[model samples]
Target: MSELRTLYPVIEPYETGWLDVGDGHSIYYERVGTPGGTPAVFLHGGPGAGISENHRRQFDPARYDLTLFDQRGCGRSTPHAGLEANTTWHLVADIERLREKFGHEQWLVFGGSWGSTLALAYAETHPKRVSALILRGIYTVTRAEIDWYYRFGVSEMFPDKWERFLAPLKTPAERADPVRAYRALLTGTDETARLEAAKAWTIWEGETITLLPNPELTAPYHDGHYALAFARVENHYFYHDAWMEDGQLLRDAHKLAGIPGVIVHGRYDMPCPAKYAWALHKAWPDADFHLIEGAGHAYTEPGILDQLIRATDRFAG
Candidate 1:
């Protein structure tokens, strides 16, 4: 059997800066890898998770020019965790602005999890601007997807973690609808309540993303500052359904026709069911699809990461 792939050696960004994306939001962005190589953009998940150093290692630094940025309210973006004017469309526009700023006519778009959702939105909205696509852990943000993670599906699989997730919400109604419940606390006036709820919300995702418990992955979710932005921005987006119409991404799959693409998904992905990834593969038949065994939702999983790096390397040509 072939050896599993892993991240490229850690490399620092050659250039980094902040973009004033308006609506009182200043986005933090960085450029890495060869300047004149294949142009590509990396979209981080969580709609709130922001970018991390590991994200820069996914592509071959010698072959691809990559741009990664923190969306509206998360990471180093100003007004930390602010929700105003932040939506799926706002982010899509921000991507375009960055693309224009870089002067790339079109670039490969690579995203995983929620990043997959944004990539689809952006690519569909401006198909002419995408040279290729590489998506992983496919998520369309439909009601079923949201309910699976926050309400019923994953809850049944991880009852112990589910219990901890529910401990923050006291009422039957809140437990019944945790997304809205968390949103209320996250956006409410009570700072203490907000931070507490944030930890619960963030921890739930951190612990559950991997098939196995990974302290290194889950530890950051517990930090009060990180959790607040993660939970608040994530909840805000979820509560609003990412401002996307039902089944919008899938329905627009036709827009992806003729684009070079790859889909990498874990068979046992919890936050994002494998079914949706299968659905996307069916919708975009031209794209190569890999259903990895012994993996979960996180891009860091061995099988998933191997497939992801393979996809990027393949597209780097």
Candidate 2:
């Protein structure tokens, strides 16, 4: 076995600003690492979970120029948690706009979890613009995948946590379709109901993302403000099935044909099952795949992060 890889170091963005992607959406973006180096973009998961400072350290700062941004309604993006004009496709276009803004003909794209879903969508839609891809905790957002996390599968694995997740919905019918139930509460005019639903939804994910209980990791999910956007936007995306046809991403895997890629997944991941990542590997046989043992969904998990850092390092050259 070789030594595990870790994040490079804490580095601040040399440039940062907001881009008005229209539709009342202005996404916050930042640039870090070497200027005019090998270009790359980082996509944060959650559909609602925005970028973090740690994300900037995933690549070799001296060798790659990386861009990280908040999606339509999350993070520092304006209209925080606003669901209008925010969908998988809207995010895809925002990525292209960012690439053009940076004047990069092509660049590496790195995403984890929901980020992986978006990366696949963007690469498939515009294959020629992607130089490489590094995906972790692959989540295709298929109906089965959605139900697994929100409805049934993970519910079995974390029964205690599942109960807390279920507490927000008081009835059997609402419980039967948690996504729909949560969406109603998240979008409802009652501020108290919205906040209650938000915390429940966000905390469920935070608690289950790791193999063991990680209070540090799960703490932020409790924040009323962050949870509101994280839950609302995330639930909104899942409720609509990300506006994607069933298994659409896997159906279009061939679009990644010539692009260099790496797929890293945790064997114990709960939010995203390893099976979908396996399916993606089979579909795009050209990409290297690693089923990391003893880890869960988060990119911070040691084994998953090791492979991710290695992929970025290898692609930097």
lDDT of 1 by residue, 142-250 (tens): 9999999998899999999999999989999999999988988998999899999999999999988998888888888999999999999999999999999989999
Error of 1 at 216 (Å): 1.2
Q: Please, what are the lDDT tens digits per residue for candidate 2 over residues 1-317?
A: 89999989899999999999999999999999999899999999998999988999999999999999999899999899999999999999999999999999999999999999999999999999999999999999999999999888999989998999999899999999999999999999999999999999999999999987778777888998999899999999999999999999999998899988999999999989988999999999879999999999988899888999899999996
- Name the runs in model 1 displaced over 4 angstroms: none
Per-model CA lDDT versus the true structure: 0.94, 0.94
Cα lDDT for residue 76, model 1? 92
In model 1, what are the clashing residue pairs, if there are any?
A: none
